[model samples]
Structures are given as structure tokens and as C-alpha cells.
Target: MDSVDLQVLAAARRWAAEGRRFAWVTVARTWGSAPRPPGSWLALRDDGRVEGSVSGGCVEDDLIARMRGNRLGGGQPFILAYGVTQEEAVRYGLPCGGTLELVVEPSPDPAQLEDLAARLGQHQLTQRQVDIASGTVTIAAAERGDALSWDGGRLITVHGPRWRLLIIGAGQVSRYLAHMALALDYEIIVCDPRKEYGPGWDVPGTRLVTTLPDDTLFALEPDARLAVVALTHDPKLDDMVLMEALKLPAFYIGAIGSRLNNAKRRDRLARYFDLSEQELARLRGPVGLAIGSRTPPEIALAILAEMTAVKNGVAVPLRDAVAEP
Candidate 1:
């Protein structure tokens, strides 16, 4: 789930606490070109207020229209299948035969929802199993590798912090990266031990850690879901962290520098640290797409955009992979 889904989950709990009825919508399944993936959420209040989306925009509009007329979900949970036919697809503007199978849970147990929200915020992997036949909802701990599983009778969705990013420099680029990462539901930690760079680091929803980057890497115990980005542009600082991060399980280990600098850095790592080609292969330098970014914010955007592609298992071509150096 992204930040928007988290917002809806929190709002649903709040509405239930207020004794106000609302429909919690879930995109249970999707056909081709679905804008939102399965398990994406939207909270719809009794007064027709919405907090998320299952379609690009059309489906929500239709739901809102039904909600205003008092003709939507109420007494029991229900299923809504949008864009079933070609005519319906054309009318709803579902691109490339896109369709959405949604589940609306009205008046769910507030206590359970709140507990789930708290646990998810704490970065715990949680699985929600909902039995449509009995209206029984159960929450349990899930493994890191769990994916959304839905049968006709029951739906199980996994929720937790999907990615952890360790930005090894609390510089200007780091700030923009942290800000962008939050929207994608990544737990970001900005690390910089230098007094000049680490002190008074302020970015909402991101943690500031004043620890040496290499030590921070060890503390993180990085797994495949973690990404380490070094942006200090200082060899002493970035090199130390990359040395440790390269040996770890992080899926992305990148540093901000140029192609020539990267080549020199790689040779140094190979000669001094005895890093193998396989290990060096894991390092992404000239990180981000080749978008000709210059400003700090644009550079940060390019970095995260590349990270996003990598996270989604998208293979970026080498020609388009090196944004800078």
C-alpha cells in the first residue's frame, strides 16, 4: 500500500470511532492497464467524502454518485465489478480493456482496523484475511515475502513498510529524496554524522540519523527490500558506506558521482577493498535515468524514479540508466 492507502486506512478508523458509517473500498482484482493494483484502498464516508481511488477517476465518481443517492453499500459487505463489457469499459474510460473488481466493507470493526493501522505504521508485516461469507476479519503476522492472495470466498492482503531506504547524506538531494520516498510508502532514514550536514536535519516523516554511514549500514541489517544511496559526493564518506553496503542484501546500492569518477571509484574499490566484479556490478553509479537533471530536486527525482523502476522489477536500459556521471 502507498501513503494514500495508509491515509484511507487511518481515516476509516477515525470515521468508525465517530460512529459514522462509511464504505471501505478495495481493488480486489484488476484486468489490463488498471491504474491501481490489487489491495489498493479508498475510504468513503457516509456523507459522500472519499479518501482514495480504485480507478483513475471515473470509478470513484460513479461510486460517489451512488453514495449521494443512498444506493451504495450499507447493511452488508458487497462486491462491485466495473467495466465488465466493452460498452461499459468505453463508458468508464477504462484503458486497454481495464476492469476492476472491488469489495466494499461497510461498518467494519473499528478496534481491528485501528490495531492494523498501528501495527502497519510500526513497520510490521500484517496480513488481513476477510471472509466474505461470514463477514469475519482476522489479522495476523505475515512473512516479508507474502503477497496479496484472494480467493472467491476470502481475501488476504498484506500490509507493512515495503521498502527501507538509507540515504547516506543529509544534504539537499537527500531532503528531496526523503520527501518523495514518503509518498511511495518507503521508510527513509537520512544518515550523516558530520556536524555540518547532519545537524538540524528536518524533513517530515523521515528519520535523521547522526551515525557514520558504514556503522549505519550494519545497524540497518539491510535486506533485499532496502536501498542505500550515497549522496555526500565525498569519497571518504561515500566509499566507506558503499564498501559495507555492497556486501549486504540491499537490492540497490548507489552513489552520486560521474561516470569517470565511478570508474575510478570502482577501480579503487577493486584494488584496495578487494571487491569482486560481482560485488562491483551491484553498485549503481551515475544513478537515476538519463534525464539531464542538474538541480538538486531534479536529481533527487531522477534517483527515486530509477529506484521505483528497480523496485517494480523493471529493467532499465543501460543507455537510459546513467543520468549523470
Candidate 2:
């Protein structure tokens, strides 16, 4: 789930609390090209109010009209498809013969939605299963790997953070990064055994561990969905963790520092730590994009921007190109 979907959830809950009738729309499938991915959410209120999006503009317009006219859904849930034909695609402004299949629930249970929100708040991966004909819904615990599944009759969507970010050091950059990463569907864990930093570390939605960086990394047993960022700027702490992190299958392992410092760090890892060239290659030193970030917040933004690009499989410039050689 991204920030857009989270905002949609919040808006839907607010409307529900006001006792307003609303329908929930979810993008079930898409073909060719889509403005949004499958599993995106949209909430349509009774009085033509809308939150979230399923398409760029045209689809939302039609849904708004239908919602205002009380024709979006009957008693039970139904499937709606748009841009099936070339003319329909053109009419809906879908790019390259794009098509979107959506599931519309006329009367979603507020209690169930609340339960889902609560589970997500607790950092638990949850699965929501909806029956198309009966409008029955079930919520259960889901695995990190579980994804949205849509059969012809049933739709199951997974919610909560599927990714985890472990930040070493509770310094200024870690504070900004941890706060921002929450909205990107990341379960943040900040590790720092330094007592001086522990008292000031108070970012919500993040767990702070008072353990050595290397010890914390050893306990984490990092997988592909995990991203480890070293921000202590202390080679004693950062390098110890990197020695273990470089050999793992983590999706991203980065350390923040100057280009000269990172080059020196790389050399130390290779010479003393016995890290292979292949293992050393995995390190993203001088982490984050070259956005000319000078402050802590800007640095945080650049780091997440780079992380998102890498996570999405978008090719980014090599570190050498972005940093002074």
C-alpha cells in the first residue's frame, strides 16, 4: 500500500463515522497500460464526494456520476470494467488500449474497515476477501509475500507494509528518513545502543532497538524485502553492520557518507574484511540520489527517491556517476 491508498482509507473511515452511505471501489485487474496499478482503491460517497482514484480522470467522472445517481452498485458487490474496446478506450482516455476491471461494494461494513485499519496500525499484514455475489467479507492475517488475488467471483486483497527498513543510528537523517518511510509502506526499525541518542529518538511507527549494529543485523536475518541503511557515520558501528549486510540478499543496503569516505570504506572492507568484489559491489555508498541535498530532510527525500526507483526496477545512474570520483 502507498500513501494514496492510505489517504483513501482515512477518508473512507471519516465518511463512515459521519454515517454517510458510500461504496468502495478497488482496481482488480488491468491490461496493456494503466494509470494506476491493480489493488488501488477509490471511495465514493453518496453525495458525489469521492476519495482516491482508479484511473486518470474519465473513469472517476463516470463513477462519480453513477454514484450521485445511486447506480454504482445494487445490494451486493459487482465487477465493473472500463476501456474494453478501442472506442471505449479512446473515450475513456486510456492509453494504448488499456483496460481496468474494478470491484465495487455498495455497502462496505464500517466495522470490518476499522478492523483492517487497526491491524495495519499494528503492523500486521492482513488479507481481505470479498465475495462478489453475497457481499460477504472476511479479514485474516496475511504473509509478507501475499498479494492481491482476484478470481471471477472472489477478490482477495493484501494490505499493510510488505517491506521493512532497518536504520542504523537514530541521528538527524534517520529521524527524517524513518518518518517519511512510513508512508511508503515500510515497517521501520531504528537500532542504536548509544544512550545519548535513545532519549531523543521518538518517531512513531518505528521500533527502536538498543543493540549494537552488527548484533542487530545478525538478529534481523534480512531477506530480499528488507533494506538496511547505515547512518551513524561511525565506521566502528557502520562498518561492522556492513560486513554482515553485504553478504545478505537484502534488496538495498546503503550507507550515507562522502564519496571519499565511501571509497575508503570500500577499500577497508575489501582489504581487511575479505569482502569479494562482487559483495562490495552490492553496497550503495554515498547513498541516495544526487539531488544536491544539503540538509537532513532533503537528504531523507533523496534517499527514499533512490530507494523507490531501485525497488521499482528503474535503472539509476551508478554511484560513481553521481558522486565525485
| Top candidate by lDDT | 2
lDDT of 1 by residue, 208-230 (tens): 88878898889877788899999
Q: Which stretches of candidate 2 lie over 4 Å from their true place?
A: 133-135, 170-172, 175-187, 194-210, 215-223, 247-249, 258-260, 267-279, 290-299, 315-318, 321-325
Off by over 4 Å in 1: 65-76, 318-325
Worst 10 residues of 1 by lDDT: 316-325
- Supply candidate 1's per-residue lDDT for 242: 92
What lDDT does each candidate get? 0.84, 0.88
In model 2, which range of ten residues has the least summed lDDT? 316-325
> What are the clashing pairs of model 1?
258-325, 259-325
lDDT, model 1, position 88? 79
TM-score of each: 0.90, 0.81
